[model samples]
Target: MVEISIVISLILIFDSYLLGKCISKYFNWNADYFPIITIGFFVILGIFEFFVFAFVKFQFSVYYILFVQYILLIIPIFVAIKVKVNLIPTQKELKMILGGALFTIIFAFLMGNQTLGEAAFDSNFYLSMVIENSTSPTLGTINGYTGNIENISTLHGYQGFYYFHSLLLKNIRNILSLNNTSLTPVYLWTSALTYFYMLSDILFHSINLFLEKKSLHTKIVALFFVLVFFTNYFNISFPFYGNTWKTLNIACNMLILYEFIKLNNKKSLFLLTFLNSSLIGFSSSGFFIACFIEISFFFYLIWKKEQNYTIYLEYWISCLSLLIFALLYFSGNYTKISILILAIYCLAGYTVYLTKRFDAIFWKKLLQFFKFIFLISVLLLVIVSYFVRNSMFSGSDSQFNGYSFFFRLNSLGDMTLNYFIPVNKIEFVRNCVFWFIIFINCFQGKYEKEYKFFLLLIIILFVNPFVTPFVVKYMTSIVYSRCFEIFINPFCLLIFYTGLIEWLEKNKNIEILFLLALEIGSIGIIVHNNISYYSKFFIPQKGYNPVYRVTNDQWELYQNLIEELQSSKLERPLILNQDIAVKAYVSNIRVLIDANTSRSAPAYSDENIDAPSDWLNIFYVRDYYGQHIWKQDPDYSKICDAIIDSNCDYVIMDKEVVVLKGDLYLPLWFDARGCSEVIYDNDRYVLLRVRK
Candidate 1:
């Protein structure tokens, strides 16, 4: 497996290099920056893969994707090999890269090997999608509860957004000849490492640009930036956060923002536009960030009086193309409508550009003004309507609720302080004094514009948590307070680092002390957090603890159940409780349901359940497990009929059911329904064979 993982990594690196070389030639970037460029190109390639498999209707196979990818690499490889370019990094840069990679590997290894966290379910869902897509030709959900392939379009529009990571893992699994369970750790490690590389490269470039230096010290500072943001400690204990596709989105947007700020050439502009549009295919958060950045750039150009109408034209064109692509790729009517509204916004911007270019009579100008006003009004209405619709219909979770505005505000403060300064009182005081010095220095007017921009970003980050409650109230079902941590924490660190660097340049004597203190404090926090995280798994008493870490016994039990199911050769779909669904999905078996829904499993109701009719009925049966048997209820009869009609061939109940729902309900319900045959039983789990 190790050998195969290395081979797969090499393939990705080679492909990234070839694509990066082509982009470098077009953009006139230095060859030493190939690795950084390669990270961006890798994301571009993943987007291309998604488009081919989804809209282009290409077969969803690893070989097909790679064959095409490699074929496309030939031209760039040939061109790059023939050209004389200084592709080698400086010694200092090499050391930084190696050090960052080593640190990332060690951290990812620890994270992957430790017990599961909140993101484990999401990781499993992504893995299952990869397995299904790789084994089957079609791109759709496997209906984990029913084994039926449902069009992914109807389920969720962003299905293709996450396929990038899934495809990578699928390739790894295919090459390693490993099962999904074994590949879980590898997926975590690879995804985290890739994110670290991309982030480190971005920081290296940004810091080098800012300091006008690329020494060993600068490299160390770059690593410091990476460690500061990428650690689980800074990110609110989200160890498996790397498994989500949003990480890729964040990296791409940050890099795109940097490129937009630095480069203004046509080729670079085109690439930036392409990157902006590509975010639409990744995640909605990316789309939001891209829109914000693009709009901000448009205004910046206007403010700078650049008079580059062509840039404006490219921006509008890209916006329109993104809208059309979203319409084609995304199934939700609201999503498509949102894209159309954004297109109208682009249209309004174009009209404003035209008004500035071509002189018009009073009546014509008046007419254009009214048209723009009408467009703006419509845009506002569309946005408000969507928000209202979501608020009215979306399901809520108790865990996400109860976060008061003040509490969230306070949490942000602690997160920001801990992110930069040490948690102890003395270190915190020292950091605050240093921060005041940096603040005074920043006002001295060197890089005034840059400081202003950073200040604006800091303000936005600080206020975002306060705004999240209202956003969740009016626009989304899930709480995005966690998302604020993922997106804002990096900028908070960057802003502080920028200020610190400026201060360090003036106060050389304090530089070494600050760096030393930072290293020690950062490492200490990471070690402490990791120890706390892993210690939960070793606690003696456990009966469905809220912080449910996967135990070795439970893992073995799940494996045994999979083996039994395989031996049974059951044709019908298997039903698995939400808690064990992740492991069950790893078996690559067709399931009636796996826990990928928006709401908590126990809180599921008829209106919010995302499953087949029959499977949903069975879900309700198990969901209300010990609650007074609703055998007399119509819904209960529906569940019994579904079970008796062969909707599910098997059911796996974990020990949590007995603890939470009691054992009496399962037996009584089965006997009353007269449809289930007990096949396997133990203290930890139970398996039932549903009869036709």
Candidate 2:
């Protein structure tokens, strides 16, 4: 398993660099930009793969996707080689890259066992995805998760793009002849390593942004800050640690923001558009980020008089095409919608491109008119949203009820901001001092305009003052809150650091040693607070580590169950009560009632659960079917009836469960004796074959 993980990591590094080089060649960017660009290109490729395989039916072999991906890579490799792009790094750059790589390794070793805290279930879902996609790649449909449940509609829309990454990981595992159970650990390790790499990469670039002198001493000091800042892991945003995709979105957006700030010509605009669209494809929250980026860039260009309007129009059209195509494809359609959208966008883009040499005044007037129309449209939308805010409450989680739009927005903002910002009186004083320095430097700072514009953008978007009613009416608050973490909060931190670093560099008295000491001292305080904070929140589970996702006992039981099922020669066995862990670890198993949504098991879906009330209770409650109620012993007779009704071939249960019958509790195996034949039994788990 360790060898396979190392192999996968090497492959990831190589493929990302190659892809980044291939894509970056168009923009003429050097190898310094590869790490962040690599992540964006990889995600873009995965999303493109989804479009390419739109026609493929569910249950198709993962080998098909693998074959297509390699073929895709080969084309780019050929072009890149023919173009003779430089792949070498200078000594300084090499050191920075190695430092980042080393940080990834050490961070993974220290943090791999840690769960996602409240969101730990998401990791299980990801594991289930890797396991399921390792066999059959489903295009966002629930059919892959549900066994014997067929013709179910799609539940997850654009999220299908997210699964392709998991499929790619598992495909590599299969190529290396690794056991399926190795996927959980490999995934956890790779995610942790990759998450750390992103932070290190972000830190490397961000420090370079502020540092005019790239001396070895300055570099070492910056590296020291990275170590200190990240070691206190809880000081960072939770999504950065807990969710890989969300982290990718944050990185991509940050890169896009930086690119927009450097917006100069056609190439940069094209790169920004590519990154922006790719981010939108990966995360729905990215839509708002894209709007902010593109709009901000549009105005920035106008303000700077760069006259790249034609390219901006083309970029806008491309984004529109992508959004429309994704909407159509994930709407459960396998038709010509993609083709139609592409053609429409192509024609629109061509028309815009032809006007590049048109009179400047005419183009300016046209842009102004478009701006007027857009502003009016936004105004009307905001007004209309106020009347429709009540609609969001219907069929939604009751927890969101009774809170005003601004209250909900502020609450969500506080949740994400709390990770980095302190609320203590000491922190307030420290912030006041820091802000005082930043305020004095603002008048003559090298990046004053850029940093202030970013701050203003954050205020407008973060507070979302004008759009609160509209946001509440249309979008989920939790989902919208991610915008704060992914863009707003990060930008706030970036502005703070960029200003402070610039201020420090201007002051000769503040040597590298002083800066390093300040960073260490500040981070030490934060680390102390984190130890206290996390000790209360992160309770260790039995048989589980802070670094690993699965418990040793659960892994052993799943591995044993897989071996037994294989030895028994059950082909694509439909399983009941297997849960996400079993569905993920045991290859070739189809679940009948996942008891969870089809985020992991795309085969079995709950989207079609519309039975009458009594039947709903039978399957959802009384029978303990179609639900995962932890520690609640199921009624054996009802479970048997459910297995029969659902036509499940096998049923799995914890051997420790004691079924409740009237006034007495009895061992599950004893009560379930006549229901099924025991095929596999162990201290932790029991697998039974339903007697049809």
Candidate 3:
């Protein structure tokens, strides 16, 4: 498995280098900045996968996709070879790369070795889908609980967004000839490591761009700050166990920012559009973040009076093209109409420019005002239409109830504020002092442009939650707001540090000593927090029990359960507790209940009610809240009879279920129906065979 992972890593690096060189040439960027280009390459690759799955309507397969990629690369590879781009790195660059690699490996090892015993259902649910799709080659795989093929693409919205990660895992599986269960750790580690490495590379490059005179010591310090901030600050809210997609999207956003800062021509427009659209393939929040940033940049350009007609033409063309592609592939009516409106807007803008109407002072001012209004109005309409179409702001009686709305808003507010002032006391004080330095230097006018841009981002994120109640009805406000923070917080920190270093360059020795002391103290706080959190896994800490640790007995018990189920040869759906579904799916067996029921399970027969005899619903609710309402219900016998008459061929009860449902009721209910036989019994679990 390790050898297979190394091979996959090599393939990824080679492909990224080739594709990066081609993209850098197209955009007229220096070939030395191929690492940034590599980030763009992955973004484009994900978008390509989405298009293939969307239009082709076939199951995702690594071999077929790679074949297409290689064929398409022939032209670029030929051009690159003719150009003879230098792919080697200088000593300094190589050292930075190696340093980033070492950090990523250590982080990935920690993340992978952690037990999955307490992993979030969301994480396991996506992993199960990836594993299932690999074997079957279809996104519409049968639901573990209901045995129905679901159109998960439309239901989840993020199904195609993370396909690239799934593709990598599938490739690893094929190369190693390993089963899904054995490769679970590899999947977790590889995905986390790759994303972090890309993020580290982007951060390093962005910092270098900000500070043109890069030094070895400065580079190492910057890398340390980036690693510490991300691992500590982000982990407070977004942990590595369940939020892998979020982490990847955040990194992609930073990559977009790097590109935006360097925008020069039509090629840059294309690259931005491609990268933004790729976010839509990953997560809805990511897509929105991309759109927001693109629109903001558009406004900034117009505000600055960048009268390059070609740039405007390229911008509008990319927007129109991207929306049209989104409409065709994703089948969103909003995207369809967005293209039409954008076309009209672009035409009007072009008319003003072509006619030289902006030559006169009054006319120029008036036209600028009108342009601002037009752009802002169009953006507002798009946002409003999204909420309306999704019924997010329906009514008080809707799922967007008062409690949920308030709770979401509060959570968003807390999270946004926490990003600036961390929850930990020492870190909070250090962050406060750091921000104080930035605030005091805000009036110096040295970084006015950066201040304006990032300040606008900060304001939007801070205000989003407060206004969300009026705009979107049913959506989780925190989720939407957190997306912005995830994308913006890292950039904010980068900008702050960049400004600090610039200040230190000009300031006196005493001022430099004071600032250096503050920064070092901040770094120390972050490192302490990380060490404290990570240490709980090995050495137990008071009031901080590690979630990702399982005992030897529990591991052995689950291994036995998996082995028995695999050899059962049962032809009917196995009824399992919801908690056990992850194990079942990893073992490549079908179960009757799992966490992925939002789109998979059958719809309710009546509104506000579920059938009492529905095994899926019973176990779903039980596992969801860890409560056994089924056993205590007055209609328990009837529900048991219904399940007995259904197609359920086996029932597996773990210790939790046995404790909740009790030995007497479970055994008597099945025995009385004369359809169940005790097959296996142990202290940790019980297995029953249902007669056909």
Candidate 4:
């Protein structure tokens, strides 16, 4: 796993450099967003750097320390590109990131992964902190700490993308906990650190917006406003606080992209490429789709304004680097999505070449080849889309509450934004406004051709909804793939917008007003969400509400159960489907399976309540019919017995599985004679042993 991880890390470094160059070439830095971004990255570097040195000194693991150090070395230097001056101090921006980390710490101590302190959509994230450094990284809620079997891989959109983040977090967390046995501090630190990364993203870029060196106090205050206002807005105004991973990552990528464009240095490009890849890896399957969009748009810009097609080498390097990570990702769909990504970028470049010049018969035939492939792709897409629409809905993989075609068709406006300013919507409006303003102003000049494309792109996008609805249903069906669809084109539009905004137009202020109105509209939609969502925090609601979470009582119960099992003297008989498996790390007992592995089991799946009876026949539990399956240490007669095979210690029957729904792990006697012994029993769970 470490070998694979190291390879992945290397690829991420490579992609980060290349993708940053491709994107930076097409995007212009906007002052409004860059200042805070600048401070955010610098602070991230300093703090993470401090932690690395401190950790290495404590552990003496030079190599591990260096990997963490790379984060600081790579990320902050990119941020520094936005810092033009040599005299100004960045102490204030660093403090804000620290202060934000402090605030995050306060919440970390009070919160665990359980529902008690758990926020909506924000799972405890402590597991991520714990196992980022662990050797065997698994997915789902149940870890060695909680013996419950959990299939975490399924919960987070795609397993491939999810595992990448999991491994990194576990590896990091373990590095922190190498000597100290206590986990709470580890928990507190990881949580706080991630928040620091968040602040780094915003503050570092925002600080870059200042043309001249501003007061340390001024930069500090501005960074604070960006973080607090945005944090509050997201928690209150958008549902994204729970679901979206791209919010911070995209900002960081854009900052790197902008920095590269401003500096145009190989070092800058390398920084952009690496971080952009990580941000994409942060939500791989989702962001893979986004990168595809960006790569395509990038070439369109290049083809429109480049020296030659030889520049295509850069795109290949970045995409190839991205493909390495994508291959490591666990889903088939994500791998397949790369095809569309390639096609999009390739097609865009060809379109630009054809539109820009008339190169007679030679060019026309080449164009025909591109056109043929494009038509075939569209045909294939339409056919697949027709079927996809028939099965549209989120949670399809979850067995939770997956929707079919009918439900999606019923939900039009509610699907994308809920009239609320979701991060996805924020992107949509920002890009749309950019298109409207930039195109209208550039009636002539360099942007004229691109301007026309923007108008056509808008018409196609709006028309896409109408056309897709009849076939593909939901606009957001791709799942977690919300940002890339719009961000790439907007980058192109804004590149034009920025150039046009600074241009000496006849009615520049009027265009600015038009753009401002769009920005305000997007903000307004998001703010209204805050007003309505105000009821969720401070005063909690029931479990059914989207905002409603597990009650405090339930959390206390879950924790106490964990503690009780720790104290019990059952000889730590390999527990299956419970927390005891990983928590076994501290407790002197060994558990078999975990909720991390079991929750995703087919038996409890909403879609497939697979037969647990099969397990009785397929393993050591064989010859153990309905009654015998619940017997003490399940009887394995012949190793080659027709029915039983897999080796497992014990099964944890809990509220997690409806098949284990009855208060007990099934009655002892099939023929009425009591056959099994009860080891542990509770309102929420019960443990049984197979008898000899």
Candidate 5:
């Protein structure tokens, strides 16, 4: 907990403020938003490094990433010193930091113990990727599940957050002298803190946006309202456990919304474009969200009649270049989506060109026509994707069900209902009823144009399958619920908070009573429903918790296994261990087979074949390595023969299984077929040296 506090403070204070200050010079943003902008900058920098590593083909190490972060850190420090800029946080900034930290601590306490949900889920792979990045020279190019060379561009393009995780994990290990035994807890805590910081920053900035002069009381009140109504009420606990990439995605989208609302100059536009690029590599549906935000921002600019064609051209061109890079370097449906977004930005640039050159009503009409075409194109894409969802995702059927026109329609309807239906725990505030009041308030109150824009976005993109089909899988995917909870829920709260603040301002006499009642009520509900219902949302996670993913015993086994593997004579010795908990820590070693495949197959065997070509290798390997399936203990000679046949240098097995007789154990195999020497033994696991 102390370490978590230190890391969070270091990030919020130094990395966020200083590094943010340096980048803000280039991007030009308010100093108040430096924390989020710094985070956004890191997201972009991390992605840039991801591409650099993938395209340039270099041996990667923790030092490489550390060097990059140090460079970023030094630049800001140098600038602040040279310019004599004050580096200390102001009293107001200190309050924001303390407030955010308090919320984070509360969140951590609520989300107690966690575990990796399933073996085949993306979280397992993401864990492996981070470990690989931390220790292996292959960086993210090698697949942890299969010891095969995988192009990072294909599978890991949108997962740049892994690089960030790798960076933090390495720093923690180096700073604290912790080993793989401490990795899981540290990783979990760091990830949750990072998300909380991003979220808190969003809330703080949002409050200021609404209130003209935000006092400490007002800020705290607004934060409490959002933390309860938006964060606690929404079932966003999945990200805190292991799906941290989604949390980052949600944070990035919130930052995008913030920038979109405050976008008045070229700096905000540049930030938005950079954020869009980062989203392209964030997650599976990252680009879908990016496109939704981009199109809305584009239209917002046009509607405001703030068409500085040159600035718009610069922004579109910047997006165009990044989109083309993503298209060329990456594969899958996202690339296809990128082509569409790329074309839209390109066409938008051309239209801006024509509108600037001709300055005619005709060109303006053409721009309007292009907008309609874009909408129609998006609708057609969704319809086509729906029809071919089964074929396109034949292997990955777990992500989406077999396609039916009626099923798609039913899914959309269900999503609409889910958006308005509050969770069972917080039934007092039905989302539908809350939204109804807010919708009426939008017409009743005097608000900024951008506030209405946010409202419009919630109505259109919150449950619109056609708009977010790629990310939401036509509102049928398991991620659909969590996505909206993080994606649309915050914006809704912002609007609601704005209206509430205005109403409170008009009736100052009852301000304290209203806030006190709401705060007390929200806290009461949270305490009543302390147990998270995230697991029951859509997919049944076999072993899901909100905190530490690996158990103490499992972590001890990992440390022991790693110690033995490190002492081996062979360079990159191949060891075979089927313990699922050991998967996150063994990325540096060459494993004969994936532990995730052996451990998680029973639970997620149906969903294992998400992609035919991709998962067939895993299934084939699992068939041969029947450690879990084959119940009988084989002869010592047979076990030795199996190890040698598989070309594995070492094998770690349970102490109970490697017995020569009932109570006897063999030091070395003495058989004609093959031989193995007992190199290391523990109460739980036995490590054997397989000889050729």
Candidate 6:
């Protein structure tokens, strides 16, 4: 246990430091977020540790340890270094030091010695995450997950990700010869921590940057953006475990931006080039696409301002190198490196224009500039082509209407959270629910020119999905490919808030009042929305939910329900009433068919045959993957069929949703056919058995 503890600490340190070093080295920025990040990491670990030590042997195995501790310390750094990433231990050290006091204070408040580590679900999830960790210790792989990712395991759509991660986890499980899968509470908390801290990193930098340019009053506004964007109402609403990494991608992208803004050296340029490239590549194309927007804006700024490409030519080369590396490393088997090569060919061809056009001294500089810009443009075109191919191929079906609808209604509530000023002694959260709507407007409107640019770029980030939610909803419901879009809306908000705060620094009264309103609104919305949504469904999720009050009581409550399900003698299979619910999925349990995937098929699939698609919903609804399934009606035939066909046992699902009343009678259909029976019931959910 001690050895394991040490290993955990090392991993945490390595993870934090590697990111810190890379940020400082390549971006030449003062990004020392270790205190908060470390606290977040450890607080989460400590939460789980309480339960682990409480029940387990707590034995010490440091002596017999494989001595991988050293590797743990250096691997992340080495990887960054091998890539010749320029990191700044000195600047990072200072940030870590200076930021330490504040981090300690905030962390203590966030954690408060309440080790929330106790197991909240079946041990299968626990064992799976551990066994899975042994084989695939690859960088960026979230250590472990709880659910089985077989054909039938989805709650909504075909989870291309679930399958992908499962393959890696299964291999590790096999090395240890484990036959079952499980997720630990620690896995949940750690994963959550990873995402939260990723956002915190962005908030930290953006806030600090805002602080640099603004007054004390304006500082608060900047902080407001920092908090709101990180605690995006949408994310707080629909935070599934799978989507946790999506949050990470956004924070990482922001950090990349913050770094990009502070680049001071070739090394920093090089690292920013790679880190941002890889982050967006692996995390999602949306973030990288956002990065592209940033790149384009920067290029326009550089070229338009100086009217010369030679000045930033090296940086462009670095970008090219990073792009090449990203394609080589981050691309899947289907990746096309040749796309970039083609751009290179065009660039070389374009150089003919430069060579023929050059005469003497006057023309030489012009010719050189043309050649450099032409080459860079060619390289860039190749990169763009690769993305275009990926985009054209990647067909998704998520609707923005669902997300947009949720955001508008909840904006007030989110503002409440933002204005929730922790007075340290207040036993209860201050209910500033009143200011939500008014303050939420703080996030809206044209704030700053730079902010406006960010907002416009953010909208442009939705370029891949030209069709809005109306089209998407009517076209494709419950498709898995639409998951990436989940982050775009909130992330754009984050960038906007960042830009807004930066613009608001000129006014003190505006900053403070703006912050108060913003915080109160965001927090209130989350807490209220969370509670209201869960009254019936009882899962940790949000979306398409309509009701009264504000805040996320449902989410907080599910933490306990998750506790009950995990430790209950019955070991109920976790069921989700709605797909947008974050906790149900993040809990890493196999779920009943849900919002994650849909039951419908779209014509686009037939029309865009080559549109690389993820039929996630089909797998679950049709039992193609043999995942967990449950019905509300105690039907014999359907249950029997499900058990025989999909190996389902007990199914725990909500049966009281008014909108779903028609479908909820599926169990009744089974009973009419004489297939299944009810085993348990509550006001919210009805449990049934098919295997027996």
List per-prediction Cα lDDT, in the order shown.
0.48, 0.52, 0.50, 0.37, 0.52, 0.37
Model 1, TM vs. native: 0.69
Listing every candidate in turn, what is its Cα RMSD in Å to the true structure after a full C-alpha superposition?
7.7, 6.4, 6.7, 11.9, 6.9, 13.1
lDDT of 6 at 682: 44
Cα deviation of 254, candidate 5, in Å: 4.9
Supply every candidate's count of residue pairs whose N, Cα or C atoms clash at under 3 angstroms.
7, 18, 7, 76, 3, 89
Model 3 residue 258 CA deviation (Å) reads 5.3
By TM-score, the best candidate is 2
lDDT score, candidate 6, position 558 = 39
- Candidate 6 least-lDDT 10 residues: 542-551
TM-scores, one per candidate: 0.69, 0.76, 0.74, 0.49, 0.73, 0.49
Comparing 2 and 3 on lDDT, the stronger one: 2
lDDT per residue as tens, model 5, 248-291? 44454555455655564555555555554555445544544555
Put down candidate 1 lDDT per residue, 239-273, tens digits, no spaces: 33422334444444554444555454444556555
lDDT of 6 by residue, 635-672 (tens): 23343354444444444444332212444533222231
Model 3, 422-490: lDDT tens digits are 445765665576566567557457574653564465344323534454334433333554444543444
What global local distance difference test value does model 6 have? Answer: 0.37
lDDT of 5: 0.52
Error of 5 at 335 (Å): 10
lDDT over C-alpha atoms for residue 430 of model 6 = 28
* Model 2 weakest 10-residue run by lDDT: 614-623
Candidate 3 accuracy as TM-score: 0.74
Writing each residue's lDDT as its tens digit, candidate 2 over 1-692 gives 54555666666665565666666676665445435434545445544535533533344555665666666555656666887866675564576678778977766655644544432233344455455555555434334344332452332334444455556666666676655344655655554555566566666655565453556555555555334333443423232222334445555555545565654435554555455545544455555555555555555544444456566674665366245534554445644665665666678577567667768887777667666665675677567666665554556343454325444433222233232244554344344544554574566445657736654544443336466556655544445555555433322344455555665666757756666665565555544434533443344456764334556666677766776676768777877653345654565667754435423222223334333222122333222332543233234566555567767677776655565668877655564457788876766667777887
